[model samples]
Target: MTGSIDRFDEVVDEAWGRAFRGRPLADRVFYLASELGDFSVLWLIIAAAQGLRSDADADESIRLSLLLLAESILVNQGIKRLVRRPRPAATEPRPHHVRQPGTSSFPSGHASSALAAAGIMSHRHPRAAPLYYGLAAVVATSRIHVKVHHASDVVVGAAIGIGFARLAARVWPPPGER
Candidate 1:
């Protein structure tokens, strides 16, 4: 069973490789899917929502948005500090991807942010839950597709994100109409 699972993981990785495989250019762009795990996407989403705030929903939006952002930072930073696991490329003899400058690479920030966004959006706004989670899946797959993180790393990071977001929501409930 373990061997089969590992083989499946490699097969999935290979399928992705074939789908996006190309010159270094193609590899580089496909590699960018890993970027989705970074904090930039979270900031962009927050900024866009903030920009479209209305007179009534403005307060609510700001409150939830701030909470989400804070939670993301806390979870991402805390896990990295705690795990400090090295990137696969650094340790493995035949790493899937190139080495990055970061010291550790246990839980991907990109995965964390994606998971947090998915969780918060899913709970705070049920209508957008599917979309947020769908996007999160894509980003998570991209990290593995790019070979920057392992399947387990993405999984754990996402779990952390969702957990943190849930905790934040309880700690700071969204604003209700007064």
Candidate 2:
């Protein structure tokens, strides 16, 4: 299994190199996909800031909001700093996207933050978990599809985010004594 994964990585890297060669369209697509992930973080912050707005479960919403907020900060900053992986544009030949000045690519911070929100919301709202994770999957794959990150980066970031969200939920269950 491990060997297969290693081979997969090699194949992906090689394909990325070929696909990205002087391809402006690919670069633009990658850039757009990378920026799109940021929108989820924006939405989460907006929803949390706005609060529940008259829902009977306003208090529950606040508690979950706080959990997600903390998870976002911790997962994004911690994983980015700890892993410090370089972006594909930095190393991979003819990387498709424009490289951000200081964004390290190992375990994509965008993927981590998105997964943290998606995982927590999905777990808290089981019926909607599938949809949430499905969206998260799109966000994760976007990273690779753009060629800014390797498949491994997306996978690890997702694991870290999901693990962190679960831990946060466990340590700080929602209000109303659930």
Candidate 3:
């Protein structure tokens, strides 16, 4: 089982290298995305913007921001500490500057937060669901493009994010819904 997992990581690393590592344009875009995703900065910005519309929007924005904070703490502090997985080694010099996260690489915190934000935001604005999820995809995948996380790590993180958002909805619901 360990051998197979190692092989899978190698294959994914090779594929990611071919797809995104050296290309200047992809590197720039993904590096920016990854940086923006740090500490869920992009999502917080969106939430603040959403808050400007009305009182209800402001309330939802506050809730989303709080949820994002909780999600980050849970994933980064709680889960990463338990997993204790090391990130991929720096095999070659990176084409762009990327922050080295000091956390376990088994489940990506950026991916988790992005998906959780997307899910919660989408519930409030169903018409903008595509935009929400599309940004989530970019933020999540950028972790891979920048070689900060394994594909499986992002996948599992996204799953956890989706689950967290669903549970949040059940417990709190949206502003209008019961």
Backbone clashes in each candidate structure, one number apiece?
A: 2, 1, 0
Better of 1 and 2 by lDDT: 2
Q: 79-130, model 1: which lDDT tens digit per residue?
A: 6778776664423232235435363566766677777767755665689778
Which residue pairs collide, candidate 2? 85-106
lDDT of 3 by residue, 1-178 (tens): 8677767877988998897788999889899999999999999999999999999999999999999999998999999999988888878888888999988997999899999999999999989999999999999999988888987788889999999899889988878887
TM-score of each: 0.70, 0.68, 0.96
Best by TM-score: 3
Compare the candidates by lDDT and give the number of the best one.
3
Give me candidate 2's TM-score against the actual structure.
0.68
Decide which is better by lDDT, 1 or 3: 3
Flag clash pairs in model 3.
Answer: none
In model 1, pairs of residues that clash are 37-110, 38-110
What lDDT would each prediction earn against the true structure? 0.63, 0.65, 0.91
| Cα distance off (Å), candidate 1, residue 113 | 1.2
Candidate 3 to truth, TM? 0.96
Give the residue spans of candidate 2 off by over 4 A: 1-7, 13-33, 42-57, 90-101
- Model 3 accuracy (lDDT, Cα): 0.91
